[model samples]
Target: MNLRDIDLNLLLVFDRMLAERRVSAVAQSLGLSQPAVSNALARLRRALGDELFLRTAQGMVPTPLAMQLAEPVAAAMSALHGALNQSTAFDPATSTRSFTLAMTDIGEVYFTPRLMERLNQVAPGIRISTVRNTAVNLRDEMEAGQVDIAIGLLPQLKAGFYQRRLFMQRYVCLFGKQHPLAAKSRLTLKDFASADHVLIQAAGTGHGQVDEQMAAQGIARKVRLVVPHFVAVGHILQSQPMIATVPEKLARALAEPFGLAVRAHPADLPQVAINAFWHARFHREPGNRWLRELLTETFAEG
Candidate 1:
């Protein structure tokens, strides 16, 4: 395997393939076609004299050879990127750099519009992309720089990471203003448990904070509908007597527009912290620092 026979671009493709494990996803990230990514992988396989990856039901599975190469290659690329950014200044007004944020659907609904509007006003040329923030993949994505910043409820940061608290999200009960529950000035735990509920099972975890708090008191509410996000809660509330427990930020944002009413949650569930996370490697990168600061300022306004 002669170094002269290898293309540096192929290594980049390989690196992204290791992160994404799918040709199409890697192509989208690199702005290349699926065929082009496939062709690059073929070249990489031939040059390296091994099947770097294998297609599997999960997507592309890295071979032992690829797994062996992943860490050093990622380190080299990260260091090169850091060094290049250090050598130059990032002028948000002029930089055409793209930022990828890892977040959940709720985060997208609550944060994207404001963030994009702010960026358009100050950094018009900058582009933003979002990836689903699954608990399983966030750390690896951040480490590889596939995701620039992650927002929402993040895992506890180990060393070599930076995180800032954006806000603490408290849950509130939401119902249509015309619903029977809306007549009550104060809602009790029994009142909450008696109502048919619309559960926003965003994580597919079968249960949520509401359930945990209710179980502690040995109470259970019947879930009449289960949906993945707060967006669906509005529509369900409009047509049914069902109640939903959602983040205060979401309830406040939608209550007026959706003609819904918010009530304090009767259950004493703890508020969760919404946070922003970035790698220590990107902590000093001017563009990342700018973005982190922008996110901090933008969400703090909410």
Candidate 2:
């Protein structure tokens, strides 16, 4: 029979009857009348094309099909009931659960410290595990429940996922105090293009939007080194003449202790907006809601 022809509630009655055996006992357990329980069983039998319950000396014997469906039906009912009973009031103080997040190194460096501090204040026992964002089956990993939240500059996300923009970042040029260009408050496009640059290619591509911007202006940078992380770029620029183009916030943080200088890009560089994403299945989940709220708040503070 087609699903439209059957009432899923009949499965719940059938599961309860199969557990309690007698129709009267099932009725009492579900707080329904005996006649209602009998009617439900009749409907279930007709739908399954089998007499799911055979009355015997032992009260009721379940058929093979009914027995096979018992565990799955019970599990589905339990999950449904739990979801319906979810609480909107999240208590982080007593929760000892761990959250798994997928993010790039740049996100980790900028956001994690504030998040951990908040977590310690509200949920001391809670832990966070971070997974590196790679260019592989991201949708499959999220759907499989391998990661709870994915945060990055996801330009092309597939359907069936929920996304929200956290914050936008602008590109800036960073140089050491000893560099020749450090004296200039504002860098010109010619100075940027002529300078030796350290490119932070997180996705293994030496070329990115900045490269495209330079190409549009009929200028190209002298790429002296290519690295994977902004942190690495920060460290490398400390003792070298290589100037790196990075997110403005990262450049500011690195410039503080590394004795580096930050300058705005002369060309109109495209802004990178970081987004927080999760599977649609978790759009209504309580724990997921708590985590996403905290993330938004933390990022806003930064």
- Per-model TM values vs. the true structure: 0.72, 0.71
Worst ten-residue run, lDDT, model 2? 203-212
Please give me the total number of clashing residue pairs in predicted model 2.
0
Question: Per-residue alpha-carbon lDDT of model 1 for 1-302, expressed as tens digits?
Answer: 67687998999999889878888888999999999999999998888899999888998888998888876776667677777778778899998999999887777778998999999999999999998776576776787677899887755455456788898878889999998889998899889888999877777322265567768888688888888766677778877888998888888877887899999988888888888888765776788999999998888635
- Model 2 quality (TM-score): 0.71
Q: Global CA lDDT of candidate 2, please?
A: 0.78
Expressed as tens digits, the lDDT of each residue in 155-257 for candidate 2 is: 5554557887888888889989888999999999889878999877777322267667768878788999987767686678888987888888778777988
Candidate 1 minimal-lDDT segment of 10 residues: 202-211
Question: Model 2: clashing residue pairs?
Answer: none
Error of 2 at 137 (Å): 2.3
Off by over 4 Å in 1: 1-84, 156-160, 204-207
Candidate 2 ranges with C-alpha deviation above 4 Å: 5-85, 204-207
Best-fitting candidate, measured by lDDT? 1
